[model samples]
Target: MNKILLYFLLFVGIQSFSQELNCNLVINAQQTGNENFQVFTTLEKQLTEFVNNTTWTNKVFKPQERINCSMVITITNKSGDLYNGSIQVQSTRPVFGSTYSTPVYNVNDKNFSFRYQEFQNMVFNPNQFQSNLISVIAFHVYMILGVDADTFALKGGEAYFQQARTIVNYSQQEGFSGWKLEDGLQTRFALIETIQSQTYKEYRQVLYDYHREGMDQMYEDVKTAKKNVADAIIELEPMNNRRPNSYLMRTFFDAKADEIEQVFSDGPSVEITKLTSVLNKIAPIHAGKWRSIKF
Candidate 1:
C-alpha cells in the first residue's frame, strides 16, 4: 500500500485497538487457604489478561477515552478448584469541564462464587451460558459501560444494559447465585433490571442530572452546579418514599455517599438543609454525613 494509505490504516488500527475499558483488575486470594501461593498468583495474572485484553463492546476508543474502572476480586475460600469470593467493581467518569472523575458504579458482590484453575484460559461469551466467573465479570463490565453511558445521555446506555441483561438471562441457565431475583436485593439481576425498568424512569434521569448537568457544570460554576445536584438528589425523594430502600436507592447511595456529602456542604444553608432532609430519608446509612450538611 502507499505510505499515506499505510499511515492512515495504522492510525485507524491504533484507534480501534483502544478497548472501551481502562480497567484495573486485582485478584486477591489471601483467604484461599488450600490453594498454593503460585496458583493464586497465576490466577490473578490470568484474570488481568482476561479483563484487560478483551474488547467488551463495539465502540472504538481513544486510549484517553477509555472508561476508568477497577475490579478487585477477593477469593475467600477454596474447595479443590471451586472458589468463593467477593468482587468489588467500581467505575468513574470525568466531569465534562474538569479533570475530576466521579464514581458511577461501586458495588461489592458477596455472592461471587466461581471455579478456576491456575493458568486456565479465561473466556467470556456474552450469549452463552458460561462459568460463573466469566459471566459475573462480563456482567459488571457491561454495567460499568451502561452506568457511565447513562450519565452522558438520558438512558443512553440502553444497548449496554441490554447486553448486561442478556448475560443475566443466560446466567439464569447456569443457575448461579447472584443471577436471579430471589438471590437477594443486591444481586446482579436487581441492579440491571432496576436501571432498565420503566417503573423507575426517573432513576436514570437522576444519574444523568448528577453527572452531566451537575458535575459537568461544577468546574465552570460551583453555586449553580450545587443547586443542580441538590435538585437531582431531590428527584429521588418520590421514589425513596415509594420503594423505601429499593435496589436502586441502595446502589445509588453506595456509589455516591461521599460525593453527595461534599457537594451539599458548601451550598446555601436552606438548600443544604432541604437536600439533606431528602438525602437523610433515602440513604439513612449515611445519616451522620447527610445530617451534618452545613453552609
Candidate 2:
C-alpha cells in the first residue's frame, strides 16, 4: 500500500513539472563507422532528456498543452571526437477548438557538425559558447517556440526569437559553420534574423492570422478561413520581392507546402489563381503543387 501511494505521488510530481516543449528526438548513426558506436546511443539518450526535461521559459504548460515537435539527427561521418551530421527539425501547434496541429517549422540543416564523448553530458550556456551539439539544439528549440507562439499572437514570439538571436550571437565566435552570415541562405543566423527583422513585421502578423483566424475557422467557416489564409500568403510576396527567396520565406514554404496544397485543393478558381500567382513568384520550386490546385 505504501509503495502504491509513493508511486502515485511521483507520477503527480512529474506531471506538475512539465515544460513548454514536448520534443520527440531521434539520433541515427548508422552512416558512421561502427567503432566505439556506443557513444552515439548515450548521446541520443542525453539529447532526448535534455530537450524534454529542461525548462526553457517562465510560462508553465500543462502536459497536454506542451508544444509538439520532433528532431532527427543523422550522422554522416565521424573522426575522433568530431561528428558531421544533418538535423531535421519540425514542429506543429494545435489549432484552437480543433484536434489539428498545423506545421509551424520545418528545416533541414546539413551543416550540423558536433563533438561528443561517451556518457558526456551536453551543456548549453546562453551567455557563452559551448559544444556545437548543445548550441545548435538550443537554437532550434527556441526557434520552434518562437514560430509556434507567433502563430497564435501577433509578435507574440519576440522573447523566444530574441533568445534564438542571443544563441546565434554567442555562438558566432564558436567557429561553427552554421552560426555565420556567410554560411549561405539556409543557415541558422539568417533565418532567426529574418524572423526578428522590423522590415518583415507584417509577415509575422500574417502567421497569426493564417493559423488562428484561418486554420481554426476551416471546418466552421472555410470561406472566411480561406480568405484569411490568402491574405497571409499574399503577405509573403512583399518580403519575397525584397529578399528573393529568403531563409524565412523558404522555411515558410517548406513547412506549409503540403498544408497549402490540401487547404486550397477545393478552393475557388479565383482564390486558386491568386495563390498560384503568389506562390510562383515567391517559391517557384513548388510550382507544380501550386498548379495542381483545383479551381
Candidate 3:
C-alpha cells in the first residue's frame, strides 16, 4: 500500500512538471563547408534534446498544450571549436476555435558566435552563464515564453521576460556581442530592454488585445475581431513617434506583416484609412504589404 501511494504521488508530480515548449530546432551548417558533418549532427541532436526536454516554467503544460516554436541556427563560419552564425527564432500560438495558428514572435539574431567542443554537454544554468551557446538558446526560449504568455493576458509574460532579463545580466560578463547595449540596436540586449520598458507598454498590450481579444474571437465575430486587431495595432503610433523604427516594432512586423495584410485584405472592412496611415508611419518597410491590403 505504501509503494502504491508513493507511485501515485510520483506520477502526479511528473504530470505537474511537464516541459512547456515543443520546439523544432534545426542546425544548418551548410555554409561551414566541413565535409565531416558529425559535429553539426551531434550539436543539433544535443541542442534539440536540451531545448525540448528542459522544463521551462512552474506552470503545467500538457503535451498538446506546449507552445509551438522553431529555432534555426545557421552556421556561417567555423574555426576550430569557435562557430559564427545567425539564429532565427519564431513561435506561434493557436487561435481559439479555429485550425489556424497566429505568429506571435519572430526575430533573427545575427550575433550568434559561440564555442562548442563536439559532444559538450548542453546544460542550462539560469543563475550562471554556462556557455554562449546555452545562454543564447535559453535566453530566446524565455523570450518566446514571455511573448506567448503576453498574448494570452495583459502583461502575463512579465515573469518570463524578467527571466530573459536575468539571462541578459548574467551573459553580459562573458563579453559576447549580443548581451551588451553597444552590440547594436537589434541585439538581444535592446530587445528585452525595450520589451520591459514602460515607454513601450503599448506593445505588450497590443499583443494581448490582438491575440486573445482579436484573433481568438474571429470565429465568433469576424468584423468585430478585425476592428479590435486594427485598434490594437494603431495604438503603437504614439510609441513610434517617441522611438522611430524601434527594434521591437520591426520584430513585431517581421512576424506579422503577411498575416496583417491577409487579415485586412479579406475581412469585413473596418475603417482602415487611419490604420494604413499608421502602418506606413511605423512600419514603412512593409509599405508594399500595406499597399496590398484591398479593403
In terms of lDDT, which candidate is stronger, 2 or 3?
3
Candidate 3: clashing pairs of residues: none
Q: Which model is ahead, 1 or 2, in terms of lDDT?
A: 2
TM-score of each: 0.90, 0.89, 0.93
RMSD of 2: 8.1
Q: Each prediction's Cα lDDT score?
A: 0.78, 0.79, 0.86
Instruction: Write candidate 3's Cα lDDT for 93-153 as tens digits.
Output: 8777655668888999999999999998888887899999999999999999899888887
Ordered from best to worst TM-score, the candidate numbers read: 3, 1, 2
Query: Native-vs-model 1 lDDT?
Result: 0.78
In angstroms, the error of model 1 at 226 is 0.5
Superposed by TM-score, candidate 1 places the C-alpha of residue 246 at a distance from the truth, in angstroms, of 1.2
Candidate order by lDDT, highest to lowest? Answer: 3, 2, 1
- Tens-place lDDT per residue, model 2, 1-295, is 1221122121112121213888889888888757357787788889999998887888877788788899999998989899998999999876654445678899998889988887787666767777888889999998888888888777778888998999889888877898888998788987887788876666798888898788766656657777788788988888777778777877888999877877777643335567788889998999888877776
- For candidate 1, what is the TM-score? 0.90
Best by TM-score: 3
**What's every prediction's RMSD, in angstroms?**
8.2, 8.1, 8.9
The per-prediction tally of clashing pairs is 0, 0, 0
